[model samples]
Target: MEQQRAAHSTEAVVGMVAQTFLRDRHQFVGELSQLMRTQLPVLDRDERLRELMEAGTTDNLMEILQFLQNEAGEDDVRAPERALAYARILAQRDVPAAALIRAYRVGQAGFLDTGMRYAIEFGGGGPVTTSAIVHIVNRTSVYIDRVCEQVGVAYEDERDRWSGNRSGLQRQWVTRLLDGTVTDTDAAEQYLRYPLSRGHLGIRAWTGPQLDPATAATVFDQLRTALTTVFGRAHATLVVPVDDHEIRMWLAWPAGTAVDSGAIARALTARGVPVRVAIGGYGTGLAGFRRTAAQAGRVRRLALLGGDHGARVLAHADVAAVALLAGDIEALREFVADQLGELAVDNERNLWLRETLRVFLAVNRSYAAAATRLAVHRNTVQYRVRQALDMIGPHADVPGGDLYPRLALQATELLGTAVLRPEPDRN
Candidate 1:
């Protein structure tokens, strides 16, 4: 009976400590997440992965706390859903299984240390303290062991499933190429079955998530075929599905081959694919491969940020200036506002004036050329330019010419109302 009472007392102490930690869950989660990200850099790759790591940490901590508070058997323990999801993502991302295991081990050690501190505080460093610590260690170890085993299974299953297909193999090679892990161009070419020494153009295509899987697959396949024909029938093309709604493609052609973006856009429209595309500059050899892919990625990000501005195809060359300026959106907006002033307002009249000024400046301030481009009379173009310049103040006529106003106008064209002062609601 005395031993039974002692066991009850230890259990109560462990539960109390767990309760204390549970109340301070946020801090514990932050510490664990920071530790995981620091120790396992793979988990820190992107915002989505970091978010998953934090969520998994929180779920695992909650599960551990609940286990400590209850008298659950070891067999009853299971890994949390979010933790399993995180393990699967790591697998999909080609992170090593060892790294996933180390994350658990790291987390287990940290949790144990924290639990020991609480146990010592509650039991006051006596026999009760020793008993409480022992109880905590055994239970926590069981929990970690069981959860790790489950997550390991999940990771392996996902890795097997993901690596079983052709897209998986392509993704692995593409990832290696992009990350500069493969330095031998011949070996990479042999593995990818595409010559790395040839000229390369990278493309990113994506559709809305509203498309069903079958429709998305068909659209992507059509895009691949269309691009292959557009680049040239003789050249090699590689297409990798990024996800359900997106794909990354690389087209290789012999040196000096001309790529017509207009033709590519027309072909997609002909097929009614209903997709948006970001095209990178044409580059040659291994350096070109990486550079073009990076450019396409940046353009894709800019496109997503700007929303649908009637631009079905965005090329890196065209948006390079805007893309660079858009890196710091707030600063870019401030620059636009500072340069254009009232011309940055998001209204019909201001938009027309901005466009006329942009065209006038683009065509070397030639009134006739700007009028031709705008499909308006030269008098009207001249009038709008004068009005725009007046609204823009003396800065538009800055000593160095239209450099500042030109950049702001380009941003206004690409970003639309994003950098513009909002139009007041009619309501």
Candidate 2:
């Protein structure tokens, strides 16, 4: 009779605990949703509020409650499956595991505080009920710890799985085509599912390493959207998967498609992906694709060398002058030093002089125009131009002598070098 009575009382306490949670489900979920937004910076975005709120109020809340209520705790068979599925959802949405774990810890604290208080008040504040509340709190803590560990395991497993096949057969096919390794163009094109016989305009884009891979994927998606917006979805076909850090795209438009490379560059740059793009002119067939891609590669190299020129957006046509002078770096360095004479010397005053000369030449040697662009008085511009002319002397005076100085300035702007200093002595 005694044992039976104790067993009945224990069952009633468990029922009371579960009832307290279920009765206030709306209040509980609402509070928890607030906690999630406050704790998880990634979930704090206005676009993410709906998803974050759903995690607390929908079927997921029930699944989480079930794991917490199970007597077997983490040993419950459903627990791993539930945790794995939830983790996969987060992974697919590109939420980091650390953020999810932090959110879970925050939820744990909220659940224990609210649930324990409800359990005690529901038990009418007696000594026996207070002891029971303590037991419930201890049990809840252990249950939450076990569930969290299991969920973390699931998150890591899903993350590992994500990195497995992200760069696979498609990447291999595209890479082989780009390198000119495969001669069977038809077989390659079929494998790649890209039309090689059609006109192609190649593009190469890449982001800095500071972006995480999942974030990089989002950036790449934005790049695709920008391309589609500029070129129309039908024309911007063939987004060849080229791993996380870089993308190689080909637009299958007609030969006479009026592609403003400047507009395309601006569209992609506006997406703010920390991306630099190289756009190539349209050409037909396999050879055309390869040639355009090569041109894009050269333009990309120049963009890298150019530094922050407004933004890192380049096109083959805009970079043609730099491309013509690509070979022999040492000779180019010598030419810059010789053409500009004493003006190429590395000093603050000389740098100011070189910049003035560059601006003057860029505006067709108009002193007034250069002054307007540089925000200086026209007399300052005239004085600076005369001084620079004296420093450059007859080296830039012959027929097309201006060409050498102009090319030197252009090389300095594109290559980031006016002169190469001699190596220091190892004394």
Candidate 3:
């Protein structure tokens, strides 16, 4: 630890550390160097810090000191990493000063014992402001107010992720895997190189044809690679196989990427899949992303449902009717209605089954609750589900899994809208 601290003498090491809190590393280092250079007054400092400021310590300490002093502390203006780490040591020991913790280390999150992330800030970090700070208290208060707006969103996002980890999140190797962004795979967050990405902003798409599982899977692979090319290497593991057919898929990504509509449209056209990319609108953090991605999935369904000619894809705009299209809600319903719905010995039973289907969808086709609501034994529920499957016949297994059940529900809902349930935000 001491050696590492001593390594701070090297500008490269200091730059690496500084990156933990600020954006634009090279630019930040330049400005910081300038500040230290101008304000340095003397290369030597009080005994404790002198070891870090020795002329031989780093090539640029004196220069950086000048920048810090010349810029009058403004040189460290966005040095959130340094400030955050500085704050961490203080906070860990219970200093409780206002501070901003920098973004997560590339793969250094597991060490984050509490998992209580403050926010999903694009910039590094800042002081957690409330009613503190003696000087600039008013200014800090205003900025803190402004930051709070974002903080709520970021905080909520982290919380959602926490919940996902508990009851919902996908598998480690398969579901939540991060492949490192295209721009940053070769870059090391540990070394302070920027995470070169599509601005940490973009969407992960569900791609492929409903008819061909092989084709869909191939398309999945292609688009995974293609989108990676477009957005640069971004995390794709959040995407799950939607159906038996490999063509259908789902993706989640950080916001603010350059893979816009026209570009995606053109790319898909060139690739022969002819895509409809759903731009999950601008929201903060991962929870915001999941919400947006689900919205995008719905939009894709809507577009495909819209009977839009040619190969179909969905972007954010098509959300209004995400449900009506996607797959066989009717089949799913028919499957449910046959298996579970038919259990209704009367009209009320039918209504109950309808409610069951609604619940299933609201819960993203979860099986356990669908049984509980029906007020039957789980095995009986399972048996009924099997029976429904038998009744629907082979088409029920239509690839791109979301469809059969989705289409079934769609048909049922279309036939009986007043009776169906609303799809929850899943937020």
Candidate 4:
């Protein structure tokens, strides 16, 4: 099987052989692994590729593969050379065959953006965390959009005007694709650095009820466009999960970007496609970006529990404390007991009072409304609400009955925040 006939006789070939020979860092050298792949990493069935790609295994090589595959669909080069180049990219990076195949489908994505993060458990990006991750993800997005636009296809402009800086090569690609200046064979053969390194992540989702490979691939390539629309220059590693079941993504935002998950969700939904988005929870670098994506899934699941059906943003800070409660009602109640047991000391402060307060808050500050909503007498509602206020402040209701329960509610709800954790149900 290793027979060599018309094997390429150039640097590309040498890169491929080196990538094919080296194994994992444990087996050989970590620096070598990084260097051989030239950063992007190789992808293929060759054991050499697997070992070489071992470091950035979780990176989105599959997404990149998908992007190149699609581009090849219409690339003027029209030669197998382009695919060969992509394969070379994967080979150079040491990506395993399975991974390379998966990456080839990335071309279908709208686009992806990479963000930065800085956390201990997950990865972190220090102070400039958000900028770093966003830059990586967004830069990739523009590169691909430039490709689509050059190909004379419809591609949306980023809502945010942030395209970091364009590399000369990417700019040339855009020019050649748009101008039809590159030879058909060359255009078809060009797909450099696709599986080059493992820095980028992917954001991919599907629409068709029964997801096919083509549809899935297409959606992923477009994800960049979707992400760039919101996160601007944030570079992202994007991936569409098998089938049309989910949109998996990783990216970061600046310290003060104040991401609007609801807003991002609405935008995808507007496409009238069955789009799903797991906006990475804000953080610094790569690992942090991964954690952000993980958190996004958690928030999306939580939103589902709350009946928000489709795509969503998962904010880490908002979900942090709550996500720790381990997602259990009783666990949350127990936490409440431990933290603010004093609130339950009196009739107005007991479990029942707390429940009444919860129901009240659930219905807003309307006592009659809360009572009606909870199917209880208005007086009963008033009594419970008053007792809750007593726990809040003895004299809080005297002049400011209005503020008493509100304060108590805040104090009481602190314990309720932890019920959002999505770990396996221990209940």
What is the Cα-based lDDT of residue 426 in candidate 1?
86
Better of 2 and 4 by TM-score: 2
Q: What are the lDDT figures for the candidates, one per model?
A: 0.83, 0.66, 0.38, 0.41
Candidate 1 local distance difference test against the native: 0.83
Report the lDDT tens digits of candidate 4 across residue range 77-189.
22132233333334322234444434322422312211111111122223333333343354345444443332221111110111222332343443343244655524422
Top candidate by TM-score: 1
| Model 1 C-alpha lDDT per residue in residues 204-306, reported as the tens digit of each score | 8887645765798899888888877776574787788775567898888666666566787899999898888888888998889999998998878767667
lDDT of 2 by residue, 43-158 (tens): 65432233434453444446544544556544553434434455554654456888777877787778777766655555555664566567666665666566567677876776
What is candidate 3's lDDT per residue for 1-427, written digit by digit as tens?
A: 3323323122333233233324343443344433443444232121212222222123232223233223234323232222222222222222222212221121112111111121112112333211111122232333333333343344444345433542123222223323322233333222322232222332434433223445655666666666665656655433443222222233444665544565666667678763345455544343443355555545544443334342344445433343433355444343534433333222443444444544555555557877776676667655555554443445543344535455444434333432233443558
Error of 1 at 109 (Å): 24
User: Each candidate's root-mean-square deviation in Å?
Assistant: 8.9, 16.8, 23.7, 21.1
- Candidate 1 Cα deviation (angstroms), residue 233: 2.6
Off by over 4 Å in 4: 1-223, 240-244, 252-256, 304-312, 327-330, 333-427
